[model samples]
Target: MRLLPRLLIILFVIFAPLPAFAVNPDEMLSDPALEARARTLSAELRCMVCQNQSIDDSNADLAKDLRLLVRERITDGDSDDEVLNYIVSRYGEFVLLKPRFSVRTLLLWGAPVLLILAGGIALIVFARKRAGKPTGSKLTEDEKARLAELLEK
Candidate 1:
């Protein structure tokens, strides 16, 4: 009984998903509402130094700077859209964790679907070609005659 409990605890410790925040205490805003908004915005911004991580979860100096900038913008009474626009202007659209759906990003959004469709079409064509081919080998007349004669012998 004790072994099972210990195993469960070890598995939980190894596999549990925990939120890993990298924001320092000093960077947080005093106002709760402002802090919440800043946090939401931070989660949407990419860490330039750590391209795969959001600023809220990154420990890079650039991520820290971006987090501060977001808080500063929120404190100045900038709405969420305004803050996002301001950051985009400064850092380019690449700063956004999810790119906005627009003409410029259409290719990025459509490429996966296009690739899957192409794969499906190619698979269907390959299956048809395989199905159309004869399954058994065709024997020559001489070979068939030799087989009949051998069977008689």
Candidate 2:
């Protein structure tokens, strides 16, 4: 019983920091509403340096810069959409963690499914071809006669 409690404590200590925010205290906004908006925007923006992590979760220098930029925009009285549009205009849509569904992004999203479907179709066709055919050449009449003569001998 004592061992279980100790193990739980150890696990908690090890995993607790994983979900902690990477935002520095110095960069935080004074207004709670603006700060909340900044935090939300940070979570939606991608860390360009880290590629896969959100700016709010990444410890990279670029991520820190982006977090500050978001706060600055919020403090300047920009609406959430304006902040997002400004960032998108500067960095292109690739800066957004969730890209808008448009023609370009649709191709990015659809390519994998299309490839998998194509591969599945190819596999089915190959399997059918293999199953339907017995790939052997028929012997000529002369070869059959020679085989019969040899067997009789």
Candidate 3:
């Protein structure tokens, strides 16, 4: 019946994006505190091969390796900063999406906003100048009479 199709659609909508358990369930920590730390480190660590993605969400083999590495480092008592520094040292910063604020990244952080502000100022001045101006020449009475006469003929 029509109701069966509706039910199937509802089920599909509810479960369409469930995460794939590609990671071995055994690899997950049973201790909540350690698992929380693992997640924090995972979010901080970028996947070397998949440069834009964090290791936690990426399904790439390298991401898995990075996740395992993060857990290993955390277990070895590395602070989050130490783990981040270690990755940055090896990957040379391209792996990070959110780069640290520095002289090299100044343009990336400031250019778009500066461009937008410059554009907005230009637009405001342009609009004001345009709005203040007359659209056409103002005709004298004689000129209007001549135009009327020309139109009549």
Candidate 4:
């Protein structure tokens, strides 16, 4: 009887734990195609509660809601752009890893390269100015001779 109980306990532990990728079956799409779409869309969405995590990777309540939103939009026959735009409108562009390039964000897009070029030019100008310094003494031969004679004494 004691051995049977131990075996049962081992079986319960082995069967009870779920895999990391396991999702609630009700949340899964019956159609594999639609499920793929859900997975792809969810990966793009940021989890608001976990700023750096995608909705698909996060177990947060907000991530769950966002995942449900993606599936609902896909079921409604919305295009990917429409689904993404819906989230962007609610959360602002900060949710996107790669923000849209625009005139308002021109510096954000261009500043690093521009700053590097400017710094390179400034460094060259500084180096040239330093390099151009007179490489020899300006003193007359008489000064040199006097210094040499003093040293000899």
Give the top-scoring candidate (TM-score): 1
**Clash pairs for candidate 4:** none
| Root-mean-square deviation of every model | 4.2, 5.0, 4.5, 8.4
For model 2, what is the error of residue 53's alpha carbon versus the real structure, in angstroms, after optimal superposition?
Answer: 1.4
The lDDT ranking, best first, is 1, 2, 4, 3
TM-score of every candidate: 0.81, 0.74, 0.73, 0.66
Ten-residue segment with the worst summed lDDT in candidate 2? 15-24
Off by over 4 Å in 3: 1-5, 18-22, 137-153
Model 4 lDDT tens row, 3-87? 9999999998998884364245677778899889888878777778888878887888888887888888889999888988998
* Candidate achieving higher TM-score, 2 or 4: 2
Instruction: Tell me, by lDDT, which candidate is best.
Output: 1
Per-residue alpha-carbon lDDT of model 1 for 41-151, expressed as tens digits?
999999999999999999999999999999999989999999999999999989999998889999999999999999999999999999999998899999999999999
Instruction: Return whichever of 1 and 2 wins on TM-score.
Output: 1
lDDT of each: 0.95, 0.93, 0.79, 0.82
Which pairs clash (backbone N, Cα, C closer than 3 Å) in model 1? none
Candidate 4: what lDDT? 0.82
After superposition, the stretches of candidate 2 with alpha carbons farther than 4 Å from their true spots are 1-8, 11-14, 135-153
Tell me the deviation in Å of residue 152 in model 1: 17
lDDT of 3 by residue, 46-70 (tens): 6777777777878899888877776
**lDDT value, candidate 1, whole model:** 0.95
